[model samples]
Target chain A: MSHAEKKARTTTDEYELIYWPRLPGRGEPIRLLLEEAGASYTDTAHEKDGIQKVVGALKPDFDPGKDNLPGLAPPMLRCGDLFISQSPNIMLFLGERLKLIPGDVEINKYRVNQLVLTMLDLQNEVHDSHHPIAVSLYYDDQKAEAKRKAEDVRNARIPKFFNYFELVIGKSEGPYLLSEFSYADLVLWHLVDGCLYAFPKAMNRQFEKSPKVKELYDTVAKRARIAAYLSSERRQKYDNGIYRYYEELDE
Target chain B: MSHAEKKARTTTDEYELIYWPRLPGRGEPIRLLLEEAGASYTDTAHEKDGIQKVVGALKPDFDPGKDNLPGLAPPMLRCGDLFISQSPNIMLFLGERLKLIPGDVEINKYRVNQLVLTMLDLQNEVHDSHHPIAVSLYYDDQKAEAKRKAEDVRNARIPKFFNYFELVIGKSEGPYLLSEFSYADLVLWHLVDGCLYAFPKAMNRQFEKSPKVKELYDTVAKRARIAAYLSSERRQKYDNGIYRYYEELDE
Candidate 1:
């Protein structure tokens, strides 16, 4: 089916997700949750030059005093009259809609929120590995800085973060956090998958020490739908976005 | 109350927060949530000096083959046998406990998550302003790189994020994101408070356009409990952890 037809076949929530047409990056988690929940929504990817049009389409009526116009950045979700940006926020909205969150309202909120933060931290680390010196400078320019940042991330941050999650999983009694599959689980899986792909050598070293985290990665991967999704072409590999495969970033 | 006596009064199940004590960076949100909720929780700050002792107290023994751990990081929550970490995760967990989240599950999750991502983005900008060159170096060392980075943040990121949130508040029908007070709102208030304090000149210049965001800030400030908390010893000033005062960072 054509892309337009596929989107038409997708559910009719007033939710319009505008993101980069290429790499999954941060948008993958939200897309996966929508898929798992079988929620109908529009996933629009802007072409390299399509950002301006996308921004115009997404921004509300320009009112300097009343309306906060120009909701900057992609990976924004426009549901009905509301426009929300940021990946974790989109995931939280979709998680609740999909029942991917736990029943215990308080703890579940904590679980999802905490998981999101962990993911963001991971993203920052990944970003730093590529552009350690400055965001404006290209990877070629920041090669030396990237090498140093990569070492620090691989040595200090990765093991520490992985061990931390390993502890959290141990506290729980079941297959999922709060004893059920949560978007948080999916989010954690995505981070692991991305990190492994991006830093294979470094991850391999840490994986041996973080057996529990590796196990969590395996278990989340084994989910029937998730397994299918990974096998599908829909799941893109990292190339230019946040987590990229740079030999320098690995051990 | 003596520190130990106050610590002793905190029930094992009621309050046990595990996070690095030296930096009030990530843990601030959880602290705010607890203060607003009026819930009792221990402030188990891991000290860097007595590293071994902190590690021993913080680590959880969990089997890797059979189960998974959910988190790693300070700002972890330990209520009874359950241990949870990740700052946003802890706050969400507490959001529910404190009844700060709205009742409608979807809206509640969405709003909370949205606010949390905003917090993360704000954090990224803050970190960039400080460590524009490399995370390995201190702000004093990276001051030159930081200056360039701060220019980008002030010119692009800060306004982009603030304006987006301002729009969110504008779209909301009432005072809060979902017409009711939530943990995300508390976080937003804190972000604004911190950014304003950290970047007074930048905020005065850029924030003039985003009245909705300013209005939201004012409303959150007027909250009686929050106001009291701000006046009390619990509210501390920025210390160059996440949001720091850098004169050159402002345009």
Candidate 2:
């Protein structure tokens, strides 16, 4: 097949995603993309003994046969004979396959990846607000440090990231990051939603100064598929995940 | 040109890298790739008034004519008309263009990127050990928190990342991550070098248990191009950079 023909083809391959049973966390973005594309996929996290499947896949001795690759952690995507890990990498693969990416232009795709990576950087900072010291430790163990870290994330880091996105939105001709709805917009939407859940007061304050980003978030949330998915049972709630709302962490 | 012929064509295009004047930080990987490829490129960070050039490019008001796109931050790559940012994203582009990535197989490229992203995650965590509270704040301002965070990184996070890489190395048939010496090896080399410099006591302890990773680091360091780069004045020292070593934070 020609390269163009391959790009035009729709994938019939089955996709199985493995992540934590509860808490949207990093897996939510992947779910959003799948939902937005109206693709057929299953989340092992939602299945019976799903969490076990996720845990087993991460084990040192867990084998997915000689053909399949092992994943480093949860939020793994299994498609056909491939077992791919890393949320951004999985998203890139799916985005191209689902034709959810904006254009065939090479530079445009690079721009999309750049935006997704920046969003991931912001998400990690938000996560560190509640667990500034270590991910393995409980929130109570790092409460004091979390308080200090949260303040910086709220007052400085959030604004820095928000302003960068706002500038990006300003550069665009439409409400989305690229002036046309792409996976980048979905990634940003989930991040903003997670921030709102984790630090309501702080995110509200930050949003007030970032009208463009807030507008983008609102625009993405209103998409028919996204709106339906947000209200569906598949949309996991925010809890002790990457974005957690600890009252003490929010000033 | 045919696809194979295009791949064989040498790129004569001029490349300019704009990054911080001092410190390797995230730009080291890009430098290593270019050096290994023997690609002709100029570093704006190394030129006269280079820091000013970097700062000006990042300014909201800076103009790059009608064709060039504005970048969010430094370590931006300007290849002819296209401008790209984000270290890992830039490295991905270079890896493909320079043919430094392993295997023409599509999945292998994904594997290379996944490893690079994982390394970036570890680098970010190592950075957080010193600036746990905020990037804008100095180490002295967050000394107590840094001390606590550094301990966790040394005892817990360092081992976790090193173990993962060691497992990866063990799986490979050669000294490199893929067993054939890809850009992934160069990136890991820089990360390990940074860690040893920033957390001497901690990395020393961690390396004791991760001989494979240490061996990989040693193998990468002995490469002729890397050795020349390391000894050249072009290589920046680690100071007030991402991997800063504060004696008080180390055990």
Best by DockQ: 2
RMSD of each: 7.1, 3.9
Give one clash count per candidate, in the order shown.
Answer: 20, 0
Query: A220, model 1: CA deviation in Å?
Result: 4.4
Model 2: which residue pairs collide? none
Report the C-alpha lDDT of model 2 over B23-74, residue by residue, as the tens digit.
8987888999888766779997689988998989878777754434466676
Q: Give the per-residue lDDT of model 1 (tens digit) for B9-59.
A: 233248766655555677777877776666666665543443343355455
Cα error of candidate 2 at position A230, Å: 1.2
Worst 10 residues of 2 chain B by lDDT: B1-10
Q: What DockQ score does model 2 reach against the true complex? A: 0.59
Tens-digit per-residue lDDT, A1-251, candidate 2:
24454345446778898999888988999988888776789998689999889889877777755434466677888887777788988888788777777765456666787889889988999999989988889989999889988988888888888888887777775588886678999999999999998889988988888888899899888877789999999988887899988887777
TM-score per candidate, in order?
A: 0.76, 0.93
Docking class of 1: acceptable
The reply for model 2, stretches above 4 Å from the true place, is A1-10, A64-69, B1-10, B64-69
Please, what is the whole-model Cα lDDT of each candidate in the order they appear?
0.67, 0.82
